[model samples]
Target: MTPRADPLTVEVVELIGTVVARYYEEYEHAAAEHSLTGAQARVLRLLAHEPMPMRRIAASLKCEPSNVTGIVDRLESRGLVERRPDPADRRVKLAAPTEAGRATAQRLRDSLDFAREPLGELSVAERALLKELLQRMLGMTPE
Candidate 1:
């Protein structure tokens, strides 16, 4: 048996979905300006932090390994990423962003401010409260 959500809960969930979708759309447009697709830009962003295996990237992006291969291939051809054998396991390959990739990723991040502009309208205390509430909703402990 399914339990129905309260009206307030439903409204909240719908608003969250709408906000997330809008953010993605804005991000995609920003990425396009850099000659990268949303998926490719996401891969660059992920690799900007550290090297990761194709499997892990696929898992993070909720896509298949084969799809990741193509994305990685494109990034690599553009000198945006490099693949090297994992230090822990020589058989496993890890992908890391190149210098150009890192620069592009940073640019992409700096260019996207859909949330930043609106969030800036809130006071510091309000922003903090919103962050805390969002963390709680995501089941994350405050640092």
Candidate 2:
């Protein structure tokens, strides 16, 4: 026999699930608006900060390396991404975002208004409290 969660806990969990589902739905819509699949848009967004090897990218995306290869292939064909030799190791290849890729990723991010609109309504203190609580729940240092 297992102990049951309290009412507040159950409600919080359900709200979290709802938030995640809504976020993904909005992300998919934004991706399609840019004429890019969710996977391609995600990869491009991941590369915005720095180039990453295919294996690392696959791990980050939680997908197979071959799938990342296909996504990269499509993005490369569109002149959005380019593959380059990893400077640290010649044998490794890194995927980097081109100017267009960066622009597209920025646009995609900008178009995600689902959370932004609601979050914008939060006061600074309330927003900080929410962030801190969420970080704590995820076992991260509340910074």
Candidate 3:
């Protein structure tokens, strides 16, 4: 049922997978340094941008809402995240990062040596091109 990809396409897919795996590996290591799991750190990072409802977070994380509840519970206990009734819908709860949580997220981003070192090697134009190419590959934006 699957169509074969060209050799170049297959190789590119494999390389992307390898790069993603290594990035996650490095991310987990960085997360451990802060006494957090990758998932916890990820939730913090997401909340650092803006609050999100439990269902939306579950959808984004590709997990069940119950799973997100547990993650939120843990984060809440750590004083990193708080649950408040959604202003848009009183029946729903939103998870938001505290000031401490935002600071931790920033620190985690700052400590990502894996991302900084190699990407820093590229010129600004090269980085822009790479970003454009990756965004295109993911269909994230219009050309």
Q: How big is the positional error of residue 42 in model 1, measured in Å on the Cα after superposition? A: 0.5
- Per-residue alpha-carbon lDDT of model 3 for 42-78, expressed as tens digits? 8888899899998888888888989889988998999
Question: What TM-score quantifies how close candidate 1 is to the native fold?
Answer: 0.92
lDDT of each: 0.95, 0.95, 0.89
Deviation of model 2 at 52, angstroms: 0.4
Candidate 3, TM-score vs. the true structure? 0.92
Cα RMSD for predicted model 3: 2.3
Q: After superposition, how far is residue 79 of candidate 3 from its true place, in Å?
A: 0.4
* Model 1 C-alpha RMSD to native: 2.0
Residues 62-81 of candidate 1 have per-residue lDDT tens digits of 99999999999999999999
Model 1 ranges with Cα > 4 A deviation: 1-4
- State residue 34's C-alpha deviation in candidate 3, in Å: 0.8
For residue 77, model 2's alpha carbon misses the true position, in angstroms, by 0.7
Q: Rank by TM-score, highest first.
A: 2, 1, 3
